[model samples]
Target: SLSLRPANSGKVCSKGAFNSCAECIVSGPNCAWCKKLNFTKTGEQEAVRCDTQENLKTRGCSETEIISPKNIQQATQKKPLTRFGSFVDKTVLPFTNTNKEKLKWPCQDQNVQCQPPFGYKHVLSLTSEHQKFNDMVSKQFISGNLDSPEGGLDAMMQVSACEGRIGWGNSTRLLVLATDDGFHMAGDGKLAAILDPNDEKCHLDRENLYTKSNLLDYPSVGQLAMMLDKSNIQPIFAVTENVKSELQKMIPKSAVGVLSGNSDNVVKLIKDAYSSLSSSVIVTHDTLPDTLSVAYKSNCPGGDKPGEEGICDKVGIGQEVTFYVQVTAKECIKPVSFNVGPRGFTEKMRVTVTTRCECECDDPPMKDNPHCNGKGQVKCGTCRYDCEEGYLGQRCKCSAGQRDEEQLRRECRKDNGTECEGRGDCVCGVCQCHETEGGKTYYGTHCECDDEHCHKYKSLLCGGNGRCRCGKCECNPEYEGNACHCKKSNEQCKTGQTVCNGRGTCQCDQCQCSRGYKEPMCLTCPGCTVPCQKFGNCIECLAFAEGPFQKNCSQACPTTKVKVVDRLTLSTEAKKCEVKDSKNCWMDFTMEELQGFDNYSVEVLREQRCPEPPNIVAIVAGSVAGVALIGLLILLIIKALIYIKDAKEWKNFQNEKKKSKWTNADNPLFKEATTTVANPTFSGE
Candidate 1:
């Protein structure tokens, strides 16, 4: 019933075996996995050969472990079964998550998501039209309202109050601050600060109020991020205008995204972001048309922008920036709201984007190219016209005419000669269209369908995928599965997931546990299972009188104890002690003596205690938790040491990155990272 194996040498196991299977050997999943594929075993696992799993005995193992096969030959030689694929691979079917078919392909498929200007994957990041503007805006982003010095002591008190309501720190939330304009602190012109409530100039517009709105006479973005960081919130920034290398240097590398254009290019920039990272959009288009309905997401579902795009970080410095964002009359004039949605399986993010565009999109259309038909592209097109001396083609744009069986092969020579500069033959009096690969057999033909693999002129000649199946490209591995699509499964259960409780492997359409496991999904925690459960008290008492608590022998106690103590313990509780032979003593004192005792207080003392309270269960739980806590503490110390070691080695990594940033790295307007989660405790696990 129990088989034990020790770690060894000369055994090149991909994974250990659960039960004997030639395909598995010392390196494979449990026997149950191989059994499903129809494999059987005999003798030692190492002596077995590869075989399929089928009709095998179930394995005995723990209930909380997922196991898979380690080798193929073990299954075959041991558990001789065959639902075989090919002789090339004789390993047993594994229950593990390892890829059964490791197909060779060109590249990995990536998901698409809009970036910057939208989406924050729990990591704060902003998007803007230009990198310079992004840096400025990020530097000035206010995750929460900061009380102005003008407001005096009350202002400071207000910030403290805000921190209390919001909490000081949270590791999971990200705050994004972005902009597309030049950085400063005001809705109107040069803003000023009014520190006192009594200051008539404190109000906006009445007196350079724009300046006064800033807690600092001139609130820098670096200050904001640092404040936010104190609250455990991270800030990522995106901008347009120019790359603000200075800002990038100040913030964490992962918290920022940037664009090189202006506010007008927001849509295109968002669409081009990569989906592999966090993303956000800070729409600068204040003038939005009511006619448009835009779907804004905090984290770009399609994806965040690719590299060469921006990704920034934040500085956790203070707690004030973790509450309500302080907005001036300027921000009030433009309505802004944060809308978040599910990012998939516990993944959620917020999105902000500009809906307004000031540029006129209805300019005159340019003349279409005769060859490309105005697609703004000219990969393979032809012209038809006579030459003006050395010129030729449909528009006489080339030096000579061309012709070939492949329609695309016929092109006007630009060198003013036939055969395209005398280096090639002329088909239809034109040079052949070339490809990165070697020249094709049908040199003079168009890219349509060919009898073999090449195409002469059909669209998607290889079925859009690379390979040609039945004269058409059959999609590769992942592509072959329902559609020629990529899979997100390669990474396993997305971001927030626990595959099979990390207990057992999914095998043969069922879960297979390791050698010592057993359970529905192999999820049995190592502990005692008591039978004195409330729901099953009667049945458990009869069946498991000795279950988990027999040492006390309360169940087998004397009947008198049960009749009094047991009954009273449930509904009420009191205890009584009676003295025997009192009548004989009373006789000696006579009836009067017995009567005098009535004067004494007749009080009953009661004593109570529970057999279960603070019992084995408590000790077990405490002992386990104590051990785990100690382990966790040790792990933390080790991790800290490793980080310190790395920091000691890479102290200059920060400075080197700064050197590669935008030319305006020294701009004082560029601030460091300040990020915070407005409310930490508010987030529920």
Candidate 2:
């Protein structure tokens, strides 16, 4: 829906059609011109060469003769976008305030200021010098008082529409608008008694002030978006959190960042916004009608993920990307054209689409054609019958009597006695097969078979390896099965002495192993013993020149060809065996079971593991040391037991003495007087 109505919608293709293909396509997207020189009938208009694409094709126009112009996209300018270039830095003050301290810091690092005498002014265009820009912001500008809702839309419209005056280059253009409050829109100008709409023209006077600031109404958001798109300028709104969402919805592809209350992060915000806008490529098209939908798939930098709306993220500089655009029309619409390109880019791809609606071979009705049995009219080589009651058939010849109905029904019955195979209806002794929703139709005489109803393999009819002929697959020589799903080769079934090792069956070159039998040709039987143990001694003798068969190794291992290797690797077709020789050395070998012969491929490990001779000197010394350590431990245990017994006895003796009360009161009865006389003398002194 690139257009409201299709281009050239009012003009019919057959009315004033052009003779050539170029002129016909130019006239209308639906118009197709025929290249056949004698396509037109003698009395018909020459303009018959041009009509809807379907009409020409139906009117005996060959595919090569028909000139239908399809939708085309051409990139006119493929010049890469400039990586770095000059950008304009025009700033407009929405309203004036005497608070110079608050305003001074944000503007000091910026170039170009809209000063007062006027509410908005454009001065000192784009400049790179910091000193010059700072001087203009700090010294030359003066502040005054103004009203609340600002004229930001008006300033944006002028900046975008007047691109040449602002010095826009063919690079990444950014229009940074730092605002802490909401701005005026289309209807707000009525409050100021200014009803004139914004003309989107440059209005700077001699002193670079907006002369028509009081004369024009604020431009609507849509108008601002258009003007910005026309100039290929990307707007970055460094606004407060409160107004961010509303402004984002208003303008498509506009970046919004939260602005600090003091505007201290204005520079950082602009830098970040530029970086984000430059790195990503956002492809967008003009507005489309509801009947049309477009989807985009791309091999973007990250991965190929289709976007409902075209978007490629994290793109690097000079990296080429391809977009596959799919445009679907839900309903037939007239041909329309639109421009699609990356946002903030001047170059674009123009796409034109054409829709075919009808054919031109549709002729008017002719009454009473002889073939219709005088009861039907003919139109487009088909009969349209208006028969009396109980009449049927193409010529209205069959009667709906019981006998005729029964015969017709019988004719539509299949070999299985089902009428029309339950897939169609019997009409006047003929079966008309039913067509499926996917456009697959049953075509057998009794409606019993169809190509599409054939068995499928791997989700493909005939497994993409054969053709489906009347509901049956005709596979190639290399493949077989009902759906052509199996390979015909039986090479994989051959193993050792018998096919499938005599334990399973082979189908489609693969082994269908029986219970207890291993897969992959059924070479191994878990419950059955292998021949490796029987041949172990022969292999040991032949491979290692050891074991009882060593002397007659040639006769014992006559069928085996032994080869020594540093390491033995076991294989699925081979059985591994580790056997001990007469010298008690372990030998590792692998024997492959061969088919149609007794010959064997035997691989043996070169290095065998054998027991080392014992050291008698170290053994004797270890035994003597062990005996001495044991004796020392026994003596220590005995000493510890004696010490414990002695301590226990002493404790018992002390306890008994305490219990008897014999300490300090010796000879209490007899000797008390003698002892008390000696002690009494000392105590008294």
Candidate 3:
């Protein structure tokens, strides 16, 4: 940033203004270590030091007020006048100002003003606090640089950076400068007098001081001239009195100069420069009254007749003169061109243009740069251009280009009358029309716009009538035509089709698919049956239940995304389910299963009915497994039968106990009687 060098710039610094200066390092910048700021050079080999900047004091500085150039010169609002007219205007100027004391004159007279040659206002203390001042100047010059094709943006920004803290208008440009920061000698400062290339000093000291440590590395005073010519800028260079020689080398001889040792001197230099360069006509060259006089001097030097004073001659080819000239040609005449200079001479041209006329005119003659016959009116009714003629902004309402008829309208009009619609353009009371990047031009009385193609845009720029504008196919901001067709895509609604596959109406360009359907394209339906498929996976709901959708079994086979190569039907084993199951679960003998059932097939009940239950191995395995189960069941039944028999025997035993109870009472006597009467008791039974 010190000198705005590119990255890796130091490696390339072998010659030119950059070599001797520390090459403006890209990293580790310490101004003290950098050779540019008179920094020390000892540690430079080991540790590179860049221009280290101190933190700037950024806040709480009083702002410089934005001075409106027009506010001070309300009395001289119209145009600048010649010396004689200026005297009169000055007399009456103060009557309008309520604050008479504040009304300072821009200057006395055009010739009396002492201005620097080419330099205009240069800046000094336009700090961040004065950002408003910088902003104002930059705003006026911004133009359409935002959209400019080339150097407009960079030029505008750079010029704006150097704008004066105070502003001046078209009446005149003044140069005012103040420099707070001091400067150093950076490059070869040896003059041809001090060390001529032929001298031994030039040969010896070519590497330092007069050659190395000099101010030549900084942007030179000559560059100011180049910038001035390009940007129409004028400079007022201010520097400290101690570096007088350095400042002298840094400024063009013609530009305003200031040598200030302090801030007070700095202010005085600014005011002095402002006073000096406050007029349009500067004494760039001076010869004398005799040389300045012409036939007009014989009559009226300001304005007169033949041999009258309004005429002037200039330096032209083969006809050289000096000072300002005065000629006499009272009426309009044919355009005659001359190579304008002190030698320029022309007898026939009515218009005295500054291009060829080296007169006191601030501008080229009115006729040569004619915009209107009168002050604001166009000479004749003719449309010169679109909105691009001599203006800026959206519709070219402001002055940006060479002022032409369109520009004249905007300046002279007091009302709603403006160049473009204030949004477009005007020509002979009609809008010249505004065209956009897409070629849409405003139409109708008020510039209500449409496409250039109107209603038919297929062939026109806007389909010829479509009026393509703002990246939209439109009749205007509102109306629709051929450019905007009625049909619209329904993709936004997730319908994926333009017209709902011809089955649904489009509302707001959205498809409302018919009943029994869902999809962006409306090409699918939920009512479609899903096949009971086992190929990929089983569909439980369709398999377990039948519905209208699945009513068509074999006839209208259920459909799925998967391809079913083999038709699905009831299981083949279902027909043979009447047979007893081998596992006792079920028997659905399929033909394939039946074919493999040869030896392994067994009718367990028939095998058991064969009298021989099975082979020993089979019987053993079955007997072990079955007999154990049967034995368990039989053991359970035998336990039940034994329990029943025990109950019955207990009942009989109970009856016997009751009978025994009766016998016990007579047991002793009965025992003796029963043994004796055994045969007798059988006869009684």
Candidate 4:
């Protein structure tokens, strides 16, 4: 029987440790009985049991029997059988050179640091050796032959042997079996000769198996599951699509792949199996150790809930799922191990629980100050200095050339510790100087001097008449100093003491007159004033005529403007008249004066020579009188004609009377008829 112990135990055991038939048969699945009874559990006492079926039956052992989970659970339910290993005090186990070599094995090739979890250093060596073995098979399958009926079943058995040789202290064992063809198990190959029919004993040659092919029958599925479960090896089958379903019945977790009947396909199938396992969780254990409990948290698909079982759920392709393995050990005993990780991954962690029954402190308290030199107080384990005023940071240390504890502002200072070059107050980090005091102003980086101005005259600054513009004087008018202190001089069309009548500015000492005033000290106006005094007799000029004298008339008086008007029929061709002609030369003049100091406009009649007001009035009166006289003469003529008609009518009447008298003489009857008609008309009344 192969006996197991904790890693801390000094003794070692191997595959061929048991000698008794019953002991060998019941010492887990890796051990088998040899009906020959020639082997001994202790090599010292040989030929002990299992030499033949009679010897095995004499010991009351059944060779056909096997260990299964049912029996293991039954035995465990009776009493808490110690199923774990003893704690190996890692401190005393000096890391030997050989162990270190194993620990650092293949990680060096991948340029990865050798950081296998603590106490699981054997993982690196096991995985490295497994990879090498797989690589050998792959090379042989590709470049050599792999048609043996046993397929890759021998490799699986060899891995079990390797695990037995290299003990996994508290680590769980995992076997990834990948095969394109159906597996040849206990009896399918020539290796079945090792087991006797009556006792189910394994007879081995020096190499531990028969070398020929097709001499054994494959074990049933149930038998394989029982063997693997008893050995504590979780089997992950990577098989072809045809065999995947059958293997899943035996092994709860299996991966399927299409195989090309080559070792290359085997590697691919195993890789696919590992990939599938990594994407989902497949926790194998039904329950954890009683003394220790686990709480799991996985940041993976279907693993969001906390306090779940020790299984990590599915995760995305390149995504990670973190399993927080919290161990609660109430009592210290042997080292306990549990496996947790993706199902088929070879790097699944084997967590070993090592309980420290007693506590030992590693860090001690210090007495000396950490930063401040004995000048400060220590509170809450920190050294705090009594900073003078403004300093802050570690140890209350101020920067160089800065004042300490002045209103808590880190003000920059000179070497003498004076701020702002000792000439101004510091605001923030910069300096400010006194710029004004009543009428005086200070200027400079430090306000050490007054702003410069004219010193030759009695001027406070810039003559107190104009503000200094960028250190240059913009002077007020009539005051012409470089700083507006000197009085202006007169230089105009006619010189006077006042410049521009004190109404304009002097640039380059020249007069610029104010509006409504102009030309050579603004003595001239553009138009004649109302009732123009100077040009009162010059009617054309006063009337705003377009004459040369109209412009000259503006300068003749103190008035502000001038105008002109056209004339007709000059009454007198005088020498002063601009137009000497007598025809259409007389006109008038009306002027608008700026009346008062307010300069309100007032229109005034100035001059008129041709067709002046009185002449126009007389002409209008004479035309009216002529029209009245003509109307009177026409009335007299009408009366005289009426009188002539009356006179003529009376004369004609007298003549008619005469003619009637003559007719009476000539014609008495006609006269008598006239008289008779007149008498008859009277008798009718």
Candidate 5:
């Protein structure tokens, strides 16, 4: 329900304190001035100086206010320091012990410890120890002997000195570092204080302790915070006002406080810091093994920012807040112990995370394993038993057939003694027969009957006149019975009383025809097939024409100078006539009955005139003219489109110019006009 109202009312410029506009505005954001004509005088006619939006609008100023964002800044709320006397106040309620008596001798005596139920006992103890150590440091050395005043490397070394020794136990761990100047790192500390740079080992009691002053440099704030956080130690910085802001840059605002001189306010600072830190809700993780990971979800008071995971918000006393925690593992691992608590407190809750990747079966037999006659083995929490012959299962007992007998009986198998009734190969617990050479397969769970195997005719076993037994043919008497080779007289192959047309014999009731005939008959001659029928017995006609033409074609032609050409297609032989041109040649001859030729015909052909060449010049001229015409049409179309577009734009411009009221003629003040008043009063009247 908190509200922070902004100081400025969202205006750019305000009143000015100087004459120049730039100088006046730059001087301060509250400065604003009017630039009206001749209004610079401070008298009654001077322009009014405006600092806010209301004032500027009331003055009727022509110029607008300049709103400069660079001059604006969000106001920050500052925390008030606790009273010098008692650090505790109503703003920070005491969740932990803040009584004066309880913290009087902090860490000085063993009896002076944090109250019971405190979250971080070691942290409180460490805070007390830090105070004691600081007291020792103040008393042991003089101002001149403290040379490395800026660096906290020595202080960092002191933190390392308490490492591992600060126990978390049922409490949290806290580390308080009080300084007046910048902290020095390991290499920047006094040479004598640093035993070795490569291997840092400090000699606090010896090795030129006086020269240790100014020999080391301070460590960066980030480095110190990281180191402290790694050790599960929450660091608090109590420093003078000069270095308080610098330290605040490194630590949280709650962890850094102003430290007065002489250590008078140290106690109060520590109490206030502890109260603020412990009161806020926070999440802390215990040391985890390499195989485990943890994540947290917070449902506390304030809303968390993006990327700010695992950070809890503030909560009042007795306010119940829930945090969803998830723990995961990389692989199967045994149970491990880890603690969870707020970072600065001593109180913590211990819990164990266990993985279940392997099964815990019933325990292995102690004396002897009954399964497999004590031969079973244990592996990965399970028992494996390899039973012997005639036995099965983990307990290994006799099989069904062998239970009644004293000795074992072999089954029919190739590996066993029976060998598949001596007819086939044994497979598994049964018999399988070997196939015969003639492809007759046995059946009946052993080599038994083969009634389907035999020489076949027309896809029928034994020509459909007999039965097959053991791969042999047994025909009926009507079939002559020798592998069914003969048939009845009516079933014999015949062609008009002679089988195969007296050219071949009959077998299996069908004719096996001889050469020159197709199957089942000796009737067809393949060589007697006809070739080109247009040329009859072409060789004989060619021979007759080659001898001599009996007469010339002039007898039938009106012109004596005539051309005769003869053509022939030979069928039986590959020959052609060499004669090409003959003067009115003529001949007549009968064709011989040569093979593959049926008849012939004759014709005469005459030559014709030749064709003329193409006209290239005419084609080129016509193409050029057509292309020019198309280009002219396209250019005319584009020009028309552009002209129409320009005309439309011009019309729009004219309409807009008429509609606008900002022209000189419309604005009376800018336009020139004359008005004459007749018979106005004279100067003296």
Candidate 6:
């Protein structure tokens, strides 16, 4: 007769507040139930059976009488390790035909020539005999020529997918890829007009040869990694120094070895990589919700500290390692389970956890308790009224006619101090919500919620696609908006067969373009200048063997056709472009975009518009003549300044003579001069 109750305000596992053992154990992680019948005092409630282990022991409850549950982990499967390991080797060859004399043993011995008509030959399957495998590699394994960046990814996809053809057993599967160059990936098959994507399925012929090599695009890096992990296959890349770093970055949890010039140390490299990978153990866990956090501590060989993501390195065979996992719940949560195991192993250890939330009480109702005015019964310390309808109050003391209206109205009022949130009236200590004109009714205990209040779009509520809850629209999966008006599909944002011409993202039925592309569908780039200037460096590299793209001219401009012409003529369809060369000379070229093709046709003028040779003699003569003219002009300017200064002096002298009291001849200074001369001789005669 156990009953559930809300946890009281106290320590998570304080006093005995639960009745049954299950309820006590579920109340909190620290809580334990006391099974002894005489654990409680005479007046104590039956809920006294629940308490913390320490409190229960302090109260004289024996350890055996306590019930507490802990987190658990179990391993369901354990298979014996297999002895022989399966290996798949992928070799990439250049597109150019090698000379028979210079060709290596396997390629030349098999008489396999190169390039456009390339094919594959499967020589061996997974075998246990080492000598037989070596003989196949030395005699039967023939090299096939393909385009560089080779189809190594395609081969990997096949090896991971076609398990039956490779005869893979229940053991460690290894894929060894030996190459001297990079690999082709998804989106590269478009160059050969292969529109089909890799399906990640077996496409091997009866002879165990990959049949869809040229018919499908190579698998993407992510796809290859996922398939490798799913198949439990470990990849070891033996590549040249050029592509070693790239392969390491592209494939996680994979080993990459740098090969020697002749690849003579491949065996040693493989052995070392295998040893290193086998000695380490990395434990990983499944996805977890945001409320729970997990930490791991392991007794590994290294002095690894606690909470280091469960990594133990330098572990030897037959050695046992112990891991201590700690799971913490940040918030109140229900039971949750997850699996954790070694990174490359298929077996996992399942861990399950349960949280404690509510308490339980087991107490029968007492008949006609006095506290209820003999109109109710007492159960779990609370009074349950059996009075007539409309009775209220804790003891059923108040009825509809005798109810305290002010006190009851307070109970029906919302948090905002409004009665029924102004949507209804308070009656009998409860809210009687009103109905709207549109037939929508108010909900929630305080009548605070209505369906008609959600957002609207185009005069339609929730855009006619979603339901309104508590004044917010909960949009359907296909549509997302404030009013559920925007569709999640991108079909309307596509131009022709491509979405936004592959240059933008579709959002809210509109194209958000990238780069310099413009929208409706991102098909136009109005700011792109002349074709020659746009692809000047590529054209310069391809036509004249010099520019920024000199080393990768083919990749820079893959489909541009260039031809030398005596002179470039402007046509209505072809645009004339003048580009400057490295020598600061303009090279005229007429470029036309071939209709229905992604290539350009260019006619480069044979002669560049270089500046004519400088006329040194004419320059020197012009310099001398200009210097003479400047000298003559300076003399004329000086002569005119002298004449103007002389005329100004004469005018000033004439004006002074006209304004003076004495004439120029009879100067006032003449008498003064005569007097001064006389005074110098005879004192002012």
User: What tens-digit string does per-residue lDDT give for candidate 4 at 395-446?
Assistant: 4343345544464233435443555444455543434443344443343333
Supply the TM-score for candidate 3.
Answer: 0.21
Q: Candidate 3 — which residues are off by over 4 angstroms? A: 1-128, 131-224, 227-232, 239-263, 281-685
TM-score: which candidate is best? 6
Question: What are the per-residue Cα lDDT tens digits for candidate 6 across 1-685?
Answer: 0112234434457444455565556667677777554454322344656777777786678876665653333434333222222212222223324445333432434456422222333456777667777765665333444345666777778778877777776555667877766777788777667779989998878866677766777789989999998888888888788878876787777898988888888888888777777788787788999998888777775525657368888877667777766778997776788977777765566777666543222333545557555666543333323443665444555576665778888888767588888877676666656766675457666887777889999888999988787799888888877899998878888756767767787878788887677878776667755556777776677677777888888888887888888867778768888789877788788887652224578888777788888999999999999999999999999999999999999999999988889535665565543433234566544
Model 3, span 1-685: residue lDDT tens: 0011233212221111222122323222222112112121211111222222221011111112110011111112223211100000111211112133323322224444222111011222222345555554443311111110121111212332333322322333323333443431212123212122111111113111122111122223344445443333344555555544554455442234456445567556655554443322212212222223233221213323433223332322333222233433333333233221211111112222222121111223333122322222111111122233453322223454446665456542335554444445554333444554554345444454443433344454544333454335544333334455434444554433236655455544555667555645455555733221221111111232233334443343233221111322334331111232222222222111111011011111111111333478986898799979998999999999999999999999999888863323544554443443356556564
Full ranking by TM-score: 6, 2, 5, 4, 3, 1
**For candidate 2, what is the lDDT?**
0.67
**Residue 14, candidate 5: how far off, in angstroms?**
88
TM-score of model number 4:
0.26
lDDT of 1 at 410: 40
What's the lDDT for all of these models?
0.30, 0.67, 0.31, 0.42, 0.45, 0.68
TM-score versus the correct structure, for each prediction: 0.16, 0.34, 0.21, 0.26, 0.30, 0.38
Following a full C-alpha superposition, what root-mean-square deviation does model 5 have from the true structure? Answer: 48.5
What tens-digit string does per-residue lDDT give for candidate 1 at 279-330?
3322211233343333221222332433211212231222111111111232
Measured by C-alpha RMSD in angstroms, how accurate is candidate 1?
47.7
Better of 2 and 4 by lDDT: 2
Pairs with backbone N, CA or C atoms under 3 Å apart (clashes), candidate 2: 1-288, 1-289, 55-360, 114-121
**Candidate 4, after superposition: displacement of residue 175 in Å?**
5.5
Error of 5 at 92 (Å): 45
Worst 10 residues of 1 by lDDT: 586-595
